[model samples]
Target: TSIRFCLDGDEPGRKAAAELMRKYYELGYEVEDCPPPAGYKDYNEWLVAAKLNLNRMNKRADEPVRA
Candidate 1:
């Protein structure tokens, strides 16, 4: 399974991410906040990143079955 990272366009989202990261730490999950490449700002910046990740995942022959 994959964890989707999402936050609203405001300060609250940042705060939520911080708190959620702490929880993930307790649960032993490594978290990486998405850094917008180049001139982008957030996940929806290019729209292609998400699609590419999903597509690559789908095409992988040995991908773990997401529960």
Candidate 2:
């Protein structure tokens, strides 16, 4: 089995993920670091950014194009 770490986006979060990855690696388990996107502190922040982008794209699609 593999472990995917969705930890926080701060230094401490990264440190914790590293420690856990090492531990699991030693145990022969696959480890994947799935931290939040850059500039985001957590998954919620990333989702907010994604939602904003989606809204912007939708708005653009709704607007009439000028020839």
RMSD (CA, Å), each prediction: 12.0, 1.5
Model 1 local distance difference test score: 0.64
Estimate the TM-score for candidate 2.
Answer: 0.81
Candidate 2 regions exceeding 4 Å error are none
Give the top-scoring candidate (TM-score): 2
User: What residue pairs are clashing in model 2?
Assistant: none
Residue 28 displacement (Å), model 2: 1.8
State how far residue 36 of model 1 sits from its true place (Å).
6.1
lDDT of each: 0.64, 0.96
What TM-score fits each model? 0.43, 0.81
Model 1: residue 8 alpha-carbon error in angstroms: 2.6
Each candidate's number of clashing pairs is: 0, 0
lDDT of 2 by residue, 1-67 (tens): 9999999999999999999999999999999999998899999989999999999999999999999
Best by lDDT: 2
